[model samples]
Target: MLDAAVFQGLSWNLLDDFRQLFTYPFMVNALEAGTIVAVMAGVTGWFMVLRRQAFAGHTLSVIAFPGAAAAGWAGVPLALGYFGFCGAGALVLAAIAGTRRSLGAESAAIGSLQALALALGFVFVSLSHSILTGLDSLLFGTFLGITRSQVLVLLVVAVATVAVTAFAARPLFFASVDSDVARASGVPVRLLGLGFLLVLGLSVAETSQITGALLVFALLVTPAATAHRLTPRPWLGLTLAVALALAVTWAGLALAYFSIYPVGFYVTSLSFGVYVLVRIVTR
Candidate 1:
C-alpha cells in the first residue's frame, strides 16, 4: 500500500506528458488496473443506476471498508476481505428485499447495514492497536504501487462480471424497468434480482480498489448516471458510460502522474465535472 501517487511531474510538452504516463512500471500497472476497473464498474453500474439502487451501491462501498480494514489487521490479502464482505452485504440486502418489503423498509435495512459496517471498520482499526499505514489508501486510494499480479486479478474479475452481465442484459433490463411485467412474462425476476445484486457487489469491490471505499460511486455511479442523462437507448448508454469511465480514469492517471495529488481525487473531480456538465446541458 504505497501512498505515493506519482513518481515524477510532467515536462510541460505534449509528447513528454504522454511519455510520463508510462515512465515507470508502477504507473503502467496503475493504468492497466484502472482500465479494468472502469470497464467493470461502468457496465455493472449502468444496471445499478437503472435499478435505482445507488443506496445499495453506496452501502456496499461502505461494507468494503470493514472488509479491507479487518484484512489488514489480520494480515491477509485485502482483496479477500473486500469481495467477501461486499458479497455478504449484498446477499443480506437481497434477502431483506426478498421479503417483499416496501421500498421504505428496504431502505431502512440498507441504512442499518451501512451503520454497522462503519462501526465494524472503526472497531477493526482500533483493535489493530497500531497505525494502519494504509488507512489513507483504504479510504482515498492511490495508484502509485499497484503490481502486475493485482492487475491480472482485476482483469479476470472484470471479464467475468462483464460477460455475465452481457449474457443476462435483456431480462435484467426488463426486470429493472418493470419487475411485475417481467415476472408475469416468466423471466425469473427474483433470480435476476439476486444475480444483479451479486454483480453490483462485485463491481463495488473492484472499483473500491481504485477509487477507495468512500469514493466508489466516483466510478460506479457518476459515469453511468451521466450516460443515462445523455441517452435513452440501453446499449448506447452503456457504451458511453464505459467510454466516460475510461476517459476519467486515463485523465486522472495522467494528471496525477504530474502532480502530488492522489488519483482518486482527480478521478472523482473529473467525474463530477463531467456529470455536472451533462446535467446542465440536459437541463
Candidate 2:
C-alpha cells in the first residue's frame, strides 16, 4: 500500500526538489518576484490591518481583476491595465469619500466599481473569443510559468514601493494610530490618507499579478495580522510582518516545488496557517 503521507503529496524528499527550483531560469525569476511581493504586502498590510482598511484593500484587488482581463484581451501586459484602473478607482474613492465618517460610502463605491470591472472583464473575454487560461491564472496565479520580463517589472515595483512606504512611514503611522492627534500636531492627515491609499493601490497591483487579484488579500492580510498579534510597537510590528512574509513566501515556494499544487495555493495556505499558529502560541 502507498504510504499515507506520500499519498497526500507530502514528502521528506523535498530537498531534491529544492535543487531543481534554481535549475530553471523561470523558477529563479518566480522566486525573486514572489519574494518582493511578499515583503511589500507584509509591510503595507500591517498598517492596513491596524487601520481596518482590509475591506478597501480587498476592493482594490477586485477592481483590478477586470482591468487585467481586459489587458489580456487587448494583447498587452496585464499590469498596465490593472494598475491604471485600480489607481483611478483609488483616486475616485479618495475624492468622494475622504473622511472617516464617509467610510461606509467609500465601501459602497468600491463594491460598485468591483461589479463594473467584473462585468467589463466578461465582455472583453466574450469579444476576444480567446481562451481564458491567462485570465484564470491571474485570478488564481500559477507561479510555475512566471517570465523574466515580469520578474524585472516586479523588482522595480517592489523597490519603488519600499521607497514610498519608507518616506511616508512617520506621518502615515501617526495618522493611522491617532488621526486626531496627528492633525492637531500639524500633520497633513488628509493628504497622508490619500497617499497611503495610493501606495496601497500600487501594492495591490503588484501582488495581484503574482497571487491573482482575489488571492492577493491573503498575503496582504495574513502576515500583518499575525505580526500585530505579537507586537504593539509600530516599528517592531512592521519588521516582524516583513519577516513573517518572507518566511511564508519561501516556505510556500519550497512546498509548491515539491508538491502538486499551485504556488499561490501553498503560499496562501501557509500564511493563514502561520497566522493561526502565532495566535495560538501567543494565547
Candidate 3:
C-alpha cells in the first residue's frame, strides 16, 4: 500500500506557506530584490527582444562573470565591475554596429565579444584562484545572501530604468518596427539604437546580479518572449511580460525555499515551460 503516514505528515497549507515566505530577514531581502529585478527585466527585455538584440544582451550577461571575478581579484565592490564592464561592452557593441545596415557586422562583433567574455571569465577565475569562492553563486545565483542595501539599489535602478524606458517607448517602438521609415520620418534612429543598447547593458548587469551570469535570459528574455507570443499589442505585451516575470520569480522563490534545488533551476524551468506553452498556443 502507499505510505499514508507520509502523505498525512506533509500537511500542506497555502496560507501558511505564503505567510512563511517573508518571515525571515533573508527571505524579505531576497523577495524585495527579486521583485525589482523582475520588473526591470520585463521592461528592458521587451525592447531588447523587439530590437532583436538578444545576442548582444547575452554577451553583456556573460561579461558579468568576469566583471565580478575581476572585482573579487582586485578586492572591490562587485557592482562596480558589473556596471563598468557591461557599459563598456555596450559601447563597444554600439560602436561596432553604428547603424542598422551593419547588422551582419554587428552579429560578427557580438559573437567575438561573447567569446572573449567567456575566456576572460576563466582568466579572472584563475587569477583569483582561491579567493573567488562564490563561483557557483556567480554562475547560478543564490538570493539568500542579498542585503537590504542591495535591494534598495535594485529598486532605484528599476525605477530609473522603467522611467527612461517609458519615456522612450514611442520612438523606440517606431524605430524598432521600421528603422528606415522611422529615420525617414525624423526618428533619430541611430541615437535611439545606441541609447537602447546602453540601457540593455545596464539591465543585463543589474539582472545578472540576481539571476546570475548563466540564467539572465530566464528572467530577461523568456517572459518577454512568452508575452510577445501571447499578445500583439505592445502595451498589453509589456504588462503581461512584467506580470509573468513576477509570477515566475515568486513561484521559483517559493519552490526553492521548500526544496533542495537551486532557485535558478526553478526560475529557468518555469520560464522555459511558459515560453513553450505560449509558443504552442500562439501557433
- Model 2 — which ten-residue stretch has the worst lDDT? 1-10
TM-score, candidate 1, is: 0.96
Backbone N/Cα/C clashes per model: 0, 0, 0
Model 2 earns a TM-score of: 0.90
RMSD of 2: 4.2
Q: Clashing pairs in model 3?
A: none
Q: What is the C-alpha RMSD of each candidate to the true structure, in Å?
A: 1.8, 4.2, 4.7
Most accurate candidate by TM-score:
1
Tens-digit per-residue lDDT, 1-283, candidate 1: 2334445555678897788677779889989999999999889989999999999999999999999889888988788889999999889989988998889988998899999999999899888877344777888887856888888888998899899999999999999999889999999998998999999998988888888899898999999999999999999999999999999999988888777777889999999999999999999
lDDT of each: 0.89, 0.80, 0.84
Against the true structure, what is each candidate's TM-score? 0.96, 0.90, 0.93
How far residue 212's Cα lies from its native spot in candidate 1, in Å, is: 0.5
Q: lDDT by residue for model 2 over 1-283, one digit each (tens)? A: 2123332443456765566667667668878988989889988899899888888888888877877877878888877877887787678667765654566776787778778877877777677777445566767776755688888887887799788889989888889889999999999989987878887888898888777878887789989999999989988999999888888888877676667666778778988998899989999
Give the better candidate number (1 or 2) by TM-score: 1
Stretches of candidate 2 exceeding 4 Å from the true structure: 1-14, 99-101, 131-133
